[model samples]
Target: MSLLSEVERDEERRAGARGDGDVDQPANAQELAAMSKLISGSGLLDVREGELEVQQRNPNSPLHSVKAFEQLNLSPKLIRGIYQMGFMRPSRIQEKALPALVADPPINMIAQSQSGTGKTAAFLLTMLSRVDPNENYCQCLCLAPTFELAKQIGEVCKRMAAYMPEVKIGYATREEKYTRDSYSNHHILIATPGTAQDWVMRYRIINMAKLRVFVLDEADVLIDQQAFRDISVRLSRHLSPGCQILLFSATFEEPVVEFARTVVPEAATIRLKRQELTLDNLLQVFARPASIDIKYQYVTLTFGLFGLAQCMVFCQSRREAEVLQKRLQSDGHDSLVLHGQMEISDRASIIRRYRNSEVRILITTNVLARGIDIAQVNVVINWELPVMRDRSPDFETYLHRIGRAGRFGKKGIGLSFVVDDTDERNLRQIEKHFCTQIHEMNMDDPVQLNELQKKVRK
Candidate 1:
């Protein structure tokens, strides 16, 4: 099928043209406005207290969740920055982990929470609370699986520590160049495992022995990679005996959890959130794919129907994203493409614009999948199902991809394309793994399309 065979090339112009500043809009614009106002006033309302099972390794000190940010007794500057950043109260993860995170004598903890639950903010606050801004030689360290994630964490911490000017945070990303004099004096360090390991082991610029709190974000992914796990273990050994360690991930398979226990031994584990085996607020569906052109057609149709609230289409490769963005734009859909290969500055700019609703659709790989929150995004499409390097289904990636939608517990739609028998098998594996049935949706059916429209409106 030709890309333009099903629809006229200039039909959008012939119909009603979108005026300037009218191209981007949510499913319900008024509703989004109200939600934004509420968020600015009371934090994200959707992430209210939910189910969390707590366990204390030590029976003598029973840790309880704190409902208010003040209960943790954070620094005045930190509290002022938190409120100014529009976080009026603690998130579900914050409420559960703050007490243990900001506790006296610093606690070693393993916390698991799904994407968008404020895990980054929770841990950043802990890092800030632990650091002594006056006399700093990298007192706190946070390592992410990727440099982009490391940069994202740095930005969040900067916002949280805006009122505390004396606090300094440094990055040791692959692209970053830092000297001993420049990097050694920061209060906190955020970097990728390989780079941080190099700085600590080879260059000896980062004195890990001085670290007070060491955080491993995206712990499951880190442990799954042999190279990263090895470096992480070596780094753990270098930390001060009394240094606190925090490991956080969206989903933790049992084996990974066990490995985490070894790293943060006797850790006060805060399973504040389970893997979220299922996203109750997200509508899941799968579509059968045909020719390449036909797949593009279905994607364009999807954007027209439910994508005004914005959409993220995940591609398996960078070229795939470029191809899809080209096809989508040719069909009169203005969109953006983001991939890990792009410069970090470009990636950050795209994410910020997407969050501000400047871009309606973003085509990319798994870079935005983990722990990046954009409230207006309500639709996520797996242009191709994610698979591991060994050709097996990557269930964790699938969960994170779809999680981009229904963010902050809002309603969302997630669709996956099954291109061949292999994709079909992968989809089946994902469904079985999550224990959630994905509807086989036929966009060709008029009644089904109407129902989807109604769901979006609802």
Candidate 2:
């Protein structure tokens, strides 16, 4: 069916439900006020105000069984790859998302869950499963927001498909590392939206005719950015009608979710409750600095106060990241900086070094916020608050920033530097939105610092 027809049918289905007494009831003033606070504070849209929605296009799908990975009846090579990766059982999101993802007749999906929840692996498995190993062309296309993230996803795909020698994976970013000829023959391609569009329109490098699966790893971020959003929509139009589109993210604003629905109509959606959005294993804390200069001092002090294996310092702008990196380095602390303005190759190299533990502290902008997983990062320092262009508190960015740490069930720490009343208000809003408290640290008192170190060590 055409995209328009599919969307119309979905609207008709929803309309029929409304006719059958399934209409959305209006929220009273108090409820509306609470919801408004939640969205504004959390930077996350509460889908229907605290309700978690899960929809499956095919309710009676045989693949809905949440059994062992072996029970999914996947290929031996793919199964061997799974076991080789040391995955004994599926994660919650994986179990819920995989069946529909790997089911036959190819259905679209929209899945949301907390970070470090195996969402990447879930979609990677589907991409690997759906590929025709015998065929030698780009069958699966995965798009990420940043080059670092795209490279990380490509690495994961290579590892997961290690046992399957026939699955060729390619990464298309601004860097000319992967040649056009190499990309054309790749069985699976992971790329940034701009580069992907360029390859399709200008270079004519990517052939979308036989594309089977199109996965958007950070769907919310991609849809929010205007440049990426426009190119992504154009690329989707070029793909064959039967291609499966899968959208995955840690958080989805309500409007972005709606835009995704329109883009991929008849998609199955999996969303988590508001309470389930925050990572429980991550210990969140805030340090109120007397001045902006003191904020830098506190970051330096944190290094000595805790057993930090590695940490990422998040700055609001490129200038902040650069200045902080220079200051930290001058203080004899080893650090590196990453931002959008840097060369793609340099950013990729910095990410590689950070992942390898060559650099202990990596100061960066929002580039590293979403899906780059570094297991050794024990702490995340918000050098500056994440705010939107209008200077509103960015709760979604906060979640992604803290999410960089505490990956894969490991304990992590998130520390934000609040220097003024504005910062304090934003922090409080985040706490209220999540319905969780961020332990306050008194940097003036050594005893409080010691107590925080003890908690972090635990």
Candidate 3:
């Protein structure tokens, strides 16, 4: 049976046990209405199948376009670049977002879609399209949270803007090669918030007056941190008055959404439903170890059984990640540890090695969670549950962590470890927050573990 069907059956049994014929209400009114319609005996699987249909039928949405890229009236050079990039047609997000983004009388946009859903290309296209090719100065600025992400975005921008040779691109990360004198000539700039702010204020490297489109690649994560948020707000203040602002992320909580609304006034928004936020193809399961020591043993055994080409093990802290990496190495597993504390060049090199399949296992904190897209990852192990400073479950972090595996319609597995009551409680909270079920697994049973791995590998 499908996973959603299993969840629905479990929910029905619980509702019957409670002696309440009504289904459990969701946390908010919007969710309540959506769930009421979803569980009305039509089946959860049907709702999942029809999610895109429902979204398209929403008359108020700006993302319902059915036109082709050529039909969008883009320049021939830009169209050729897109075709050369191997995109025959626009993805759902591209179809919906491109129309509004490239429209005249420029409008601000706040788009939230799942990872690997063409958000990067969507904004990059906008940035490239907005740049005046004749202008030899910076006209578009894209800010990401990390130098790695900024460099990655810069690479994609370079590829997409290949045919449009006049559109110069610059990287404003710490390792940027441009000197203060030559940095101002690029038409597009991809940077981290801190570096972008310094370039604007201290070095006078970026020409804020000529900036046309300002894009925040990972808006949710960028806005959540106080330091990045302050620097971003300050950077925005220096942009041209008519600069079009665009914010994009895979997930946006209520506070972040509110913040986006405040910063980008009257922006066009494209949001996915909570249920739709989690990729349906991902197989999410958790293992309950009897003790903390057993958790490491279980991971070692499971890694051997799966024989995965590449996997990412997420830890709650850098110290824990380092410790786990050492233990895995001692167990003869080839692994690398990465966190925010490492130098940017080191982090970038490690990511490149991991992406090239030179490293089979990567143990990291949340640094690689949000926007880094590596498609070869077959499994994701949550060595520790994601939580905030107050120790509450961070649902968005969990989503992004697991998202690193099942990318671009690929099947993958997310295995979370529950060591004790606190960890189990946090996992349960995450399951409830996503309105999905995370099946429990018996790590001690080799036969069952093999069967589960087979299913995920298929």
Best by TM-score: 1
Candidate 2 — which pairs collide?
none
RMSD of each: 10.2, 15.7, 13.4
Higher-lDDT candidate among 1 and 3?
Answer: 1
lDDT of each: 0.76, 0.74, 0.74
Sorted by lDDT (best first), the order is 1, 2, 3
lDDT per residue as tens, model 2, 117-144: 6677788999999998788788999988
Query: Which stretches of candidate 2 lie above 4 Å from their native place?
Result: 1-53, 59-63, 276-458
Candidate 2: how large is its RMSD? 15.7
Which tens-of-lDDT digit does each residue in 179-215 have in candidate 1? Answer: 8889888889898989999999888878888889999
Taking all chains together, each candidate's TM-score versus the true structure is: 0.58, 0.54, 0.56
Using TM-score as the yardstick, the better of models 1 and 2 is 1
Q: Which pairs clash in model 1?
A: none
